[model samples]
Target: MYTQTEIIKDTTINGSEGELVINVGPQHPATHGVLHLVITLNGETIKKIEPHLGYIHRSIEKMCESLTYRQFIYVTSRMDYLSSHINNEACALCVEKGLQIEVPARAKVIRVLMGELTRIASHELWLGAMAMDLGAFTPFFYTFREREMINEIMEDTCGARLTMNYMVAGGVAMDLHPDFQRKVKLFVTQFKKRVPEFDDLITNNIIFQNRMKGVGVLSGEDAISYGCTGPVARGSGVSSDIRKLYPYDGYDAVAFDEVLETAGDSYARYLVRLREMHQSIRIIEQLIDAIPEGDFQAKTKAVLKLPKGEFYTRVETARGELGVYIVSEGGTTPYRIKFRSPGFSNLSALHHMAKGSKIGDLMATMGTLDLVIPDIDR
Candidate 1:
């Protein structure tokens, strides 16, 4: 294991033959976070790509072991901050499973609604950032315009925009805001009209298509082997949507198609996310008007203690499947905890996808992966 200083020195050294060793991040914009990539390039052709992580490692799983069930869920929000709500939901669901807590029906619906909204918001931001990564800056502003509305809605109900720790073991922290329905409905209406503009601005552009269509192709077999999930796997025609295969929190009650594309390339991944936003909107429409008029939270004791056993729960976050596993010793705090974060798995395939592709094509491939560095580091 090389130290950080040694790794930097290694990048400056010339590889065997004419291969050049170059570093892409650890402090670079295209990474979107503190991710370091050591790429071996032979005349602008990528020979290999190695990711150096731990730049932002927070030891979240280790931290969760020391926290009570209720306290640990919030720590996950900092993992995939873009899908913070979904991350919190995963932890809460795992705790509920351990205690065999019966979440209220209204709470189930609310969880699903917030989850889908988080998915859309996450994708909207990814779309803009990915576009900007490919040198199209206008779409960044266009996409953020809609994402701001979602953030405002999140702030109104959850009292925080980025890391909303609204999800609890049995239900949400509070009831929906009085204007939640109105604001969400209005945002939906506006978003539907603006999606077309996205296509006109970037999606349908010939140059953009050329850059994405054949770049960073990963076969379905390879994607599955790398443990890819969510858009990354679905883009390769893999049926890996956890919401569809393993429904939880009223997902089985909702009607939404699992978006898939067979190309297994950057463009395919892009299309999956774009179409998925519409599916998220579909799910929201179905449950928005039908929110049950009942207790928002289930009755539970003041303190939560799980039986001596192991428990696990999985949820489909915007990036992919997030699994929370906990081992309890009949105690308030977890004996041990582990997280199966999607970004880590998806990143494992970077070398396979980038090899033999042009160095410039790296952005399109990595951008389409939509990696969140903290998620990987955590």
Candidate 2:
């Protein structure tokens, strides 16, 4: 619900400003998902923007309250399946905290590696989608060509491309594939070689530059108050990557730069994600050979139960911070669960960013938002 402020109504003597309420969509391709924005416009200037959500909310929190600790990990995979490893990590961390289980050193290293891979994959898909939203078609295919390698590696180990229930409470569900190291090395080599081509193809392209260069400017103050995270926050000159602030798994040992941009505009967001991918590759190469041999799954009783308490975990998803809040009642299931999704906070900035832009710029502006509706709705 919007704030309860009295309206300064101006019904009579309206200017030559043609005002009308326009519905952007529950189906607009540029919305990034089933997001419907009701905007009041006077000519090309936006007067007001209201977002109507819940088109995709399946009450995932309620469902988690019925599933056991071991079962809830798979449910979180649906929130941001592009970064399923991170989603699983959050669930596992919460359960681990509750159970006080000591995961082996091997599990932590593998989790960090997979988490970094998920981050790269999520950013890759976002890059393609954002480019396509701006009417650039060729770069999407180019980005996907590189991203397909990550999906193949995931499929071989987890048995599914997306929404893999790969992480358990104390350790991973399965051991790393026999060729995991070799395949990741190949992807690292391929990604490093292809990144420069992407810059030449889209990032440095004149048409894309014209569309994104100075549009949708969000100031650093606005970004902080809006609770933005990931590249969205980093683009606005904010350092809020959870991996850096709160290191989990093997993040503390790895050496990588946190990508930052001070422009606070659509182009800034694009540049931030593009550079972050490079850092992800750097971390992957550092840890590829360091994956130690040990038990993948920690020993736990058949029917797992968590202590009665509140468990909270904040993980940096591809888009931003995905916070999972779970309340247990000394049973197999949770009493209540709340997910603070990144897209919701990031999309809220859309109204402020697109205030005076042209209709075409609206697509360019929203593309930078990089929303996945299920994450928002869930």
Candidate 3:
């Protein structure tokens, strides 16, 4: 590892006595993905933490400036692959705003449904991975089983599972599959029936509580200042849900509670996501009943061209607020594109929470943070 002396310090946890510092990650599973942290500790208590990034930069932003608007949307899917649908929604909204087009009501409903499903899938993967990081492996399989079914649905409808570029500027790339409603209904029903068992299997277990509760606690005020959002911020009692702040599509019409927990620890984050899955399933239940009726795509010129101005759009992604900024010069290609990725913002809070914590707690903390590396690198 390359160390810059300017950013280095004798990190120590002072308890009116002594301290300790330990190196963690760059390879540790708990760090989530190539996240290296130089942690200062004092007998299992964290004192200071410094995170080193840029281990996976692909320069997706600079690359997007060269691609046409239509082609650029595909790159977003790679940013947060687990919640690619939400990333796709953000980019599509930006393009739609720039192009001055309206997505049909049906398209909006479908987009909402897809985005919620992606949220559920992302949470499920996190739940399983978090459990695994804490030394439980079986739950990973159970979570994967449920997530796999959702992926199959996405694959059948959007023709891709993880990187589903389902949304386009005007509307959806294609209509929902003929059996999308039935499939989603089945998944929702099964998920509702199976989700409760997760609580018994992990949340209520004595071991998990012993490992998590009160660990890496972040107060609501600190969470906001650190740029935490989605389940992480919600767990800290901060209501930073973009859906509530700015309803992009049919989110305003939906009836659902913004899940929140005041604990702001690893346990709180876990519980928030667990309940969030149920809420997402709830949203899907109401939408699946009526798929609505409309054209899958809107009419457009031979080549898509945005107005000579700047447009920005944000969406409540599973990670957090994902914003797409685009400046058009009345051309087929975007002059500049910037993605304010949620994971990047969420990752910023790691150092804040990691200071004065144990190395084991680092795993619990980072896993609860639910970071996706591509989103950070992008």
Candidate 4:
């Protein structure tokens, strides 16, 4: 058997029927993280793509079993760092469900607003990175210009940009910053005008369109079969938006369409995320000015303990649906914890989508899936 180092260094491994096996990542820039793929190819055509995970696994679930309920929630922020706010919300919601905590309306609205902002910020980064994967570098800078605004807002309110750790078991850690509304409104106004430029720069570009449009087509049935959620499923016209189907944290009160595209290709996924960013802006506009006055955090004991039971909560992260499961034994810390992260499920479909496709097209296919490596490895 070939050693791991040799496998990675060798460009090709001899396979049956003269097929060639190659490794795509673990350090490839296109992956956006430490993701490894063993691909079998016949010349430029891909025959199979096998994802080799665990390069960055931290055994987060096992670690959570040791930390108290209050502390474990923050660990999830590292899983999907791009959707850190939403990941924390999912864990907090699960804890609240077990404790029967009724979060204050003001806190609920704040949580939802933060979640939407996180969604937009995550999508902005994905768009830029996706463009860069396809050999366009200019859009990356353009997208970051708007994303930096959201980062500043997050930093000002939550004291951190990427992994905010702001959401808690009862509610958010604190109230919004005094200038939260004005800054959010400013972001909304500027984003609305600038979003169209995204289309002009990359979305409508003939070369980019050709690279993405029909590549990596996945049918709606296939998407569901692979347990894909978020844009990956919605791009195939799957109605899997957890916010719409199972609203939480004042999501029910907000008015926004569940963006969908039926084409089920790379372009369709691209359009789904692009449109969803607009919907996130809409959710923010509805809640930013309407935040009610009340305590930002609910009352809870300092030493929190959950009743013996199993609890689960699901949230729509920027990548897809993130489900948190906890098994409590009437203790301060969890007996067990498991995360049904979307990246792992979505990544499972890569082989199905990229089979028989050219190696050059793999970047577009994988880029649209938007797999966050830690999210999968965790």
Candidate 5:
């Protein structure tokens, strides 16, 4: 086992010379994005893994500093496109906090609904990609079939499938579609039936279990130390769900479990995300029928400006905690902006988790981490 210190140093054993060095990707499909991993291997076992990033660096924080507050929130969508809704929500919440704007009840519930839907969609993609990483090609098709239902729902309401940019300072950009409820309810019913098929296809397969069970264990302490979040930290039994810790946008009213697993391995993380999709369904069901009738957006000034101060807001994205911090000089533009994206922190743990593991298991571990490289580069 490699300690955190040794892993950080990435020291090579002196006696073991002529070890193979390989670059996994800057364009590899298994990377999920333009992420390059330099792997040092001793035969089939991995000795070190170093991540080379910045292929898709957008400098989003600096760009947000120049744009007006309203324009800045949309930029975050490109960072974690999978959790774009939650990312937009986080930025909006921070801007609202600085301006001291109280969102309407209807908009709050709507935001929560959209946020949960984004979570399910992200997990669906992750489920498919993880299975494919393990060489189960059929599960990818199975998972994407269910995920497209979510894309359809988003397209009907948010007007965009990937980066909706539907959130604003006071609330969402528009009201839900006339058929939103009916469509979502139907999707919920259909997805519930198909969720089980994932287990039969990949989760319970003997080959998958062997590949995942004991590989790439991330202990609870190390998870926290490295600032891992979302399913990655939860799989290690770290109780850090931002929704439960700091409820916002009607999350306090909804009842849902913070999914947890104690094993701290790749399989544990995999199970956490799968169970979380059901919990997201649970959150949606609780709020769907009870959506209050009122304006979807609260009234705000045409030109919004924040008070001269610092403000921060956090939202639980599909990957994990997304924190938006803004320093305002009482202007339409932010003095400075910083996004604490989950992918960057989670990616930091790759070397620690991959060390001492076989080269083949590298894909399994990276799949469970579910990294989005743009989020890191930003």
Candidate 6:
């Protein structure tokens, strides 16, 4: 229950000879966004981690109040750009719930396909960035080589690589490209081969294991207490995958394991994402050939209106669960909008995890959390 000022007062280390105060970023390259971490250090051991955020805040929730439901979905893309497709999907699902729109079967399969691809793309980038954060740079190049193939697929199908506004209220903005299936199969084949190489290059390296394996451990109870989700919760043995729990966008039809690890350390989180990529590939393999030949989008009015009520929907994003809540007064725009984004909740555990660890260990902890700061600030 500490106020912002009180929290800062407690974390600030005055210029004492044995202690130091350092800013990790509002612009440090290792950080994913404009996240500013004020680290209080007694030599190398971390006394505290106080994050100063909001550098990229756009008041997206309030902005959603002004924009129509269909238009608001794209704004979420700018929040967690790596998981943009999933973000948009959450908002669209919420809007569709309010409208009681029954999405076409073809649209459902296509949405799931895009969701899995987005998950893999996000994890590939996370693996690269996480390795780089631990001082191994070569994996970044190798990981991005595979990630770029997914981006090519996204560009060909969605007309944009990042922040793709593909999801609509009833279904998708457009149908899948004719080449989508062929390219995804090719990428999955190559990616499956490259994953073992990642294990060889970084995952099994003694130095990498030492940096990750017992550092910044978060237990299952603490993970749930902190409302952690996605790999962060799964790493700690908390079963919190929304796709598995809620089964939206034909997720129930596809078979894939909810990747989990009980070690609850940086390496466990790393392993969760790695295995989740394989699961995503398995999901695509199941549905890519079976996409129903039907309308890609459901019939909807040009200017949509929602009945007076509250609607909420949750979806599994690359980072975690993204919940979109909307309040409507029988209008084209939402009366109030709120997004329960995973990054903000996950960031709350940073101080808890990073304290008593080395400054170097902080990188492993934060990297495993896989934070995207705009999601927090928004």
Model 5 lDDT on a 0 to 1 scale: 0.90
> Candidate 2 at 85: error in angstroms?
1.4
How far out, in Å, is residue 329 in model 2? 1.9
- What lDDT, from 0 to 1, does candidate 6 have? 0.90
| Model 3 regions more than 4 Å off | 1-21
What is the C-alpha local distance difference test score of candidate 3? 0.85
Considering TM-score, which of the candidate structures 3 and 4 is the better prediction for this target?
A: 4
* TM per prediction: 0.97, 0.94, 0.93, 0.97, 0.95, 0.96
User: Candidate 5 on 323-359: residue-level lDDT in tens?
Assistant: 8889999988999999999999999999999999889
Measured by TM-score, how close is model 2 to the native structure?
A: 0.94
Model 2 clash pairs are none
Write the residue-wise lDDT of candidate 4 on 279-367 in tens digits. 99988888887899999999999999999999999999999999999999999999999999999999999999999999999999999
Error of 1 at 102 (Å): 1.1
Model 3 agreement with the true structure over 1-378: per-residue lDDT tens digits: 556443234432233356655666678777677766776666787767767777888888888888888898898898888989889889888988877788888888989999999999999899899899999999999999999999999999999889998998878988788888788888887887887789899988999998999988899999889777888899999998899888888898988889999999989988888888888888888888776787877787767889999998988989888888888898888888888888888888887887766767778888889988878877
Candidate 3 — worst ten consecutive residues by lDDT sum?
6-15
List candidate 2 segments past 4 Å from native: 1-17
Task: Give the TM-score comparing model 3 with the true structure, all chains together.
Answer: 0.93
Candidate 6 clashes: the total is: 0
**lDDT accuracy of residue 31 in candidate 5:** 98
Query: In candidate 2, what are the lDDT values of residues 12-107, reduced to their tens digit?
Result: 233244775667878888886788887767777776677889888898988888888888789888987688889899889888888988998899
* Model 1 per-residue lDDT at 72: 93
Instruction: TM-score for candidate 1, please give it.
Output: 0.97
